[model samples]
Target: MNIAVVTDSTASLPHELRTEHGIVVVPLHLVVDGQEQVEGDDVGTDWVVDALRRKVDISTSRPAPVSFLRAYEQAAKGGADAIISVHLSAAMSGTADSARSAALESPVPVHVVDSRTIGMAVGFAAVSASRDAAAGRDVDDVLERLERRLDASSVRLLVHSLERLRRGGRIGGAAALLGSALAVKPVLHVQDGQVEPLERVRTASKAIARLQALTVENHDNLPEWAGGVDIAVQHVDAGERAQGLARTLADALSTKVETTRLSATVASHVGLGTIGVAMVPRIAD
Candidate 1:
């Protein structure tokens, strides 16, 4: 079967890579200044980060089901016999549900995958699935590949504060870390589709160190597929820091790293000055 891969904007896959892999991206909605805007390519990260710094009240909405329908239709028109619709974690947003609703009405067979993680964590799976499809793999094989990615991948976040998370009501499993000393920096990761506390450090520097250590440890612990991995360093209003972190990770793993700026939808919840890494420890078997 000719399978197609689709993902939401929050995956934050770079345009070049998305195009190269032929992954279809559906954008989520961002409400800014009383207007609805699509996140990702439409609203530039630079402007969103700057607006957040200026205290703009930016909010996000899950992509409407119609958006997914259009994306699915486009993929079908392109001659796809089936579609693997991957999206951000269900615990994080309703984007996956929206995709599922569209899947039911899609012309071709649609398999909705709740990535259970966001950013490059989801991007990694989508790209892998796309590669599998391009190689003439069937839907079942592509789905199995995504399952392995979900099992082997991890994402760590160095959030600026818990205040934004709490305010946004997206704290999920990290709620326990709240009401602590303001100076403490919380390192978070996705656990079973919810943000959970990974570690808590006394300062931002310590948090950065902890993140770096975690990346190195995870990379070293990978199985045979270690040689082929996806590592993404992402930040909001901290591009220089992310670039530096990416360089350190590349050196530690002896592999190249990808860096991306978080979209406004993500920035609205994670807050500013957040830096993190998402990695697929190894290629799927």
Candidate 2:
């Protein structure tokens, strides 16, 4: 049966990959200075970074259920028998809830997955699911592969400050880090779908180093069944540092690393100079 893969813009999947896999993307909303714009479309990472630097009021909202319903209908019209809609962490945003609500009214069978992670972590799962569907796998088989990919993926972040996250209410247990020393640089990770503080360092350099070490540790701990891994380096206005980290990881891991800027929606909450790494174990053929 022909199946389609749908994901939100916050997944940060490259446009080429989305086109190659025939994946449908529904954009989230970003409000800057009371002007609500669509993420990645009406607003971009650069614009968001500029707004943040200027201290413009910024906030994000999940796509309406109708937006997802329209996407589902279009996919069905495109000849899809079913669809697997993947989204960022429900704990972080209500996007998954919107997808689930739309699924109820979808013309075709819609299976919504809360990745429990964000950025390329969710992107990686959606890509894998699309491949499985393209290979003629049934819905159950496709979901099985998607789950395996999600289960083996990890995301780590190094943000300049916790202020943006705090303002957006996305900082879970990391809220305590705000009370610590002003010099403390936080290394955070997505745990059980919530942003949690992983380590505290006194310098940004030390925090970045710790972030790379944690990524390496996560890569080393993968099970033998995972044939290989895919790594994505994401940043917000920290291109130089992100490129350096990606190169270091590529050489150390003996694998290719992709570097991309975070989506406007994510960057708004993470703030500028935020660096993140997403590692996903490749499924063996």
Candidate 3:
């Protein structure tokens, strides 16, 4: 059976990779300085950063269910027997809810999956699902593979400012340090599908070091080091730092690392100078 893979733009997947895997991405909507812009179409990481620098007010909204319905319709028309719609964590946004709502009306079966993480973490799951789908796996097998990767993945984000998060009401467990000084960086992670406090550091350098240490620990503790794992370094307007971290982790783990810039939908909440690493441990059969 032909199973089509779909994910939101928040996955931060590169255009070429999505095209290569036959994955369709539905973009989130963003309003910057009272001008509405679609996530991938106009509002991206650079645009969000620039708007923030100009003291512009930025807000985000989840895509409507119709957008997803249209995508499902198009997929069905393209000879897809089914669709697997992957999305950002429900705890963080309502994008998954919209996709699930659309799935109910799809002509073919549509399975909505919550990646339970954002950025490259979602990208990893979507890519896994797409690759297996391309390999002629049935819808059930493709979903199973995606689930295994989601369960094994871990993400850590280092944010320079938590103000945007607090304003967006997505601070979750990190709310404990809301009153902390602006210079006191916070290290957050996805736990139980919600953004939780991992720890707090005084400086960006220390936070980066902590992220590296976590990457190393996960790499060493994998069931089998040779089984292979995927590492992704994602950032919001922190390209240089993300590249350096990707290089270091790649060398230490002796594997390649994928680096991507966060999309506007994600950057709007995380603010600028945010960098993180997502590690998906290799799951054994």
lDDT of 1 by residue, 1-285 (tens): 888899988888889989998899998877766777777675857767777777767778898999999999999999989999998889889999999999889999899998888888998889889988888888898798778878888999999787777877889878898867375899999889888898889988889889999988888788765447889999998888899899988998889899997766777788889998998855644
Tell me the whole-model lDDT of each prediction, alpha carbons only: 0.85, 0.92, 0.88
Model 1 error, position 252 (Å): 1.2
Q: What would the TM-score be for candidate 3 when compared with the true structure?
A: 0.96
Ranking by lDDT: 2, 3, 1
lDDT preference between candidates 1 and 2, better one: 2
Per-residue error for 280 in candidate 1, Å, reads 0.6
Q: Could you tell me which residue pairs clash in candidate 1?
A: none
Candidate 1, position 76, lDDT: 96
> Could you report the Cα RMSD, in angstroms, for every candidate shown?
1.5, 1.0, 1.5
Count of clashes, each model = 0, 0, 0
Sort the candidates on TM-score, descending order. Answer: 2, 3, 1
lDDT (Cα, 0-100) at 129 in candidate 2:
92
TM-score (C-alpha) between model 2 and the true structure: 0.98
- List of clashing residue pairs for candidate 3: none
Give the range where candidate 2 is weakest over 10 consecutive residues by summed lDDT: 38-47
Q: What is the lDDT of candidate 1?
A: 0.85
- Local lDDT at 173 for model 3: 91
